[model samples]
Target chain A: MYENLPALKKPRVAVFELASCAGCQLQILNLEDELVDVLQLIEFAYFKEAMSNTSEDYDLALIEGAVTRASDEQKLLEIREKAAIVGTIGSCAYPVGIPGLKNSGDVEAASELVYGAKAALFPSVPVKPVDAVIDVDFHVLGCPIEKDEFLHTLTALLIGKKPPIPPYSVCVECRMKENVCAFDRGETCLGAVTRAGCGALCPTYGSRCYGCRGPADDPNEPSLEALLEKRGKTPEQIAADYALYNGYREGTAGRREAPDG
Target chain B: MFDRVIGKSDLTDSLDNLAERYRVVAPVSEGTRYRFAEIDGARDLDEGYIPTALPPTKYLRPPRENLITFAWDDEIQVEPVFDQSDFILFGVRPCDLHAIRLLDEIFDREKDDGHYQARRLGASIIGVECLEPCDEHCFCHAMGTLEAAAGFDLLLTDAGDGYYVRVGTDKGRQLLTELSGAREAVYEDRRRLRKIHARRDQAFEPRLDVEGSQIPALLADSNDSLLWDVLGEKCLSCGACTNACPTCFCFDVLDDLGLDLKSGTRYRTWDSCQLEEFAMVGTGESFRQPRDMRVKHRFNHKGRYLVERYGMPGCVGCGRCGRDCLVGIDPIGVFNQLKGQPVERR
Candidate 1:
């Protein structure tokens, strides 16, 4: 199918990871059926997850994970310099993701809790999204990266078309499914402000959205905060909810004032 | 109108017989809520149900429907897709019947929506009248959608010992004549129907501050009202309200390419104007960028715009939007405020 789509020269594509669980890269591998078609569209210059081959020369770089260390930042800068286009592959690479939760508390203290006695050996910096250090051509956002969105973005890039990313909130998709609102069940959910494009997967399966894909464009955080407050969510509970993927953004985890309206 | 009477017990058997000929969809209980789902028999039907979570309109305009499928090998080939499934929408409320008529008017206008028109042509509507208000959120009485005169093949009203069935068309008359247990309405049955109607009229109270005729005028030229900002502050812009509405038929079309990339299906999914990107152009210039503006537009579209365009009420006062809204934003509160009337909570 890709053979008929524009008939362009195969670009050298590379996949790189920084300080993530390698889930985003695994999503590429999880493209089991589409992977065959994808392999035919581009030449892999460097993808440690799938191939042993590595090269500095690449036309496109898909980087995943947050930059948590000085070394991670250095590697990202090098990739940005060499690659013609750099796109963040997941919420981790785009919004600092779960790794950014360290920003809500003392970085050293959190590292010591996990890597005690070796905390000094693994000195970590405040988690920053890939765009914080380098320019990002585009983003494929989700927790591990929705495989369909990743493929869609890649296909659009190959054809020189702007990737279609849904700007609406997850509630749009949630309502299409006609699922009972998570709030109706006395549960505070982030679906109201979270980005769509995952087909409202979490809420469809009877789980509240934790904002794994980050905030939608022009997210009504204040309105959501007020709604959560009405549902008896404490300030700490609301902060913890947002801290998962949005802690990197200033005031996102701390803003708990009553809606002025 | 061909008037007939069917006993409550006989109605079940009639519905069972009807299901054999068509896919009969009726309201069924789902946990604490109710939804309009396909039923095999009357056993699966919830006779006493409030407005369903989704209206019977879903059967006509599905949430996601494929518009066309495209394939390119040597040459690009495209084929339009239309839903051809013939089904009977049973147990539809009077408000929803009005909503369906509004959709029919919209889709069957100058530029006919082929998909909607196809489904509508094959679909049969069997409406059930509501004697009482479903909930505090319902304002069908005020909106003048509680009593539907046409748009239905058969209209059923609950009588004391039986159901009063009013046949509106040849299809409805044929259904009544073909059915086993239905008799011509006599003087006693007519008297009972009259008594039921008298009781029904008193059961429902007007829930609007202004008359239904004045709504369009009130909403006209009030585009820049501050009330939108006040409502927007509380509104999450989640679009639950619009999605649950019976008449909100906006959609966004997208292509889903096959793995091979040459073949794809161009599908339309239910979209909402409440979303921030609903009015965004290719150049990134959003007409209704602010949530307040988007919020105002939806109310105007429901009250003024559709009435001005279609000569019919856009909102049927089903109250699904109000009940489904995470924040308790309803038309009753907004309309009362616009009319300078004190907001009353039922």
Candidate 2:
């Protein structure tokens, strides 16, 4: 899709990070078969995860992790200025990841819990999605990016076609695979309310969905809560589950306090 | 008006006769719910039935589909698979028919999806207009899908004594012509069809009063609404809504290896965006980390982004989300709440 596009002409691609585990970058590396093809397609101007060399001007920039510190604040601005298309690679870049849960509690208290007296070494402020700092052209959602999806997005970029993102929830895929109800197994699965694109991997492996990819398009949260209640989960329990990852973002956990009633 | 009329009692014989010539799929009672399944005989057709367990789209777009077949070797030959068969979809609800139209807009537009297009092009749609609402969870009226506008080969209206058939496409006309007892739709039949639609409209209480066009604007304005944060706290992100939705069609491709590890088939399966790992990368970073943002993204995509990009609302108002929700988070309720309406708690 990018074959004839002017953007593809000597395309400069960059990969950057913030306060994160760098798992998303590892995922890109995991795309072993497609990595060489992608490398041949564009100029890998900046990638701290893969190489030592770096550059400022990039046509496309892939960002990982949330903005949690002063350095992240500066690094994100630099990336925004250098890259024309800035795409977020994981939940941290979009919803602040698990560290975002600190938004509810005292940042200093949480910092102390993690770093003790050296809490000053780590920024105690709450984390935010990459879009909170600069605009994002696209998003490849998941705890760790799906290797095929990474390749698919790159292929779309190469061919000049927009990569397709699953718009539905995990439940849809689960039903397609004919998996037994997670609730029937005495476990609360978020597959129904969660987004697809992970191919229902967690549920397939006997684990419930964690909303790692994010919510489905047009998520019915109240109804999901009621279903969870019917399956013997309390609103508090549901709230706790939601608070696990990127739940602390004001958009997610912050709204849990207010009931539909 | 034609003098010859058939009895509701004789409907079985008509269906049985039709089944001998073509594969007929109709609504059948399955446990507590109804599903559109193949009917070997007329007995399999459940006349007094509600909505199916899944939409008839399953026949059009199967759960797992083969996009292409490739042999693992230096010669990477790709062959597209198209499952186009001569089948008849009997007793499809008007809302489902409309849903098919929406699917056609997606799969049959621009660079057409050959697999979906082949099935759609070959298969025949026989619609059954609703005389009453499926259940309280249905909001087809709100979405203006209560009536079948088009996208069907044949439209069947239950008119007490017998079904009033309205031939839509050429295939429908040809099918009716083959039937010995079929006749032209009369004035009374048309009148009864209108009456059935009127009663159906009356049966469905308006669940959402917001205009369809205004949904994009409402979503844009409410991007930072407190409702998102409130619901995000409650959301488990199980992804039932997308699975139950008639229009949601995101999928993932996988290469299943054989025991020899030399050959594998690439299969595309349905995928959801609700799971935590969906947007995550290998570097242990998640983009849509906050449940609130994830929840908000889902709503915005369905209500705003899709319409902006595709010129259509992602939701068909099927209420599957409401029915399947573990927390009872109805999108209509959210929209109503966003619109400042009183939403009584379940």
Going through the candidates in order, what is the number of backbone clashes in each?
3, 95
Off by over 4 Å in 1: A1-8, A250-261, B221-224, B341-346
Question: Which residues of candidate 2, in runs, are more than 4 Å off?
Answer: A1-174, A177-261, B1-10, B280-286, B341-346
- What lDDT score belongs to each candidate, Candidate 1 first? 0.83, 0.72
Per residue, candidate 2 scores C-alpha lDDT tens digits across B144-236 of: 677787879877777787877777887877766444565567677677767877786677777776876687788888876788777776776
Per-residue lDDT value at A16 in model 2: 83
DockQ, all models: 0.58, 0.14
- Top lDDT prediction, candidate number: 1
List the TM values for chain B, per candidate.
0.95, 0.89
Model 1 chain B scores worst on lDDT over the 10 consecutive residues at: B337-346
Candidate 2 C-alpha lDDT tens digits along A1-261: 122333455478898887778999999888776666566667888899899987777898888887777778788888878776777888777655676776656778888998998988877566667776676667788888787777666655554555656656777667655355577567877776566778888887778888877666546676667777887788777776776555644433354221000
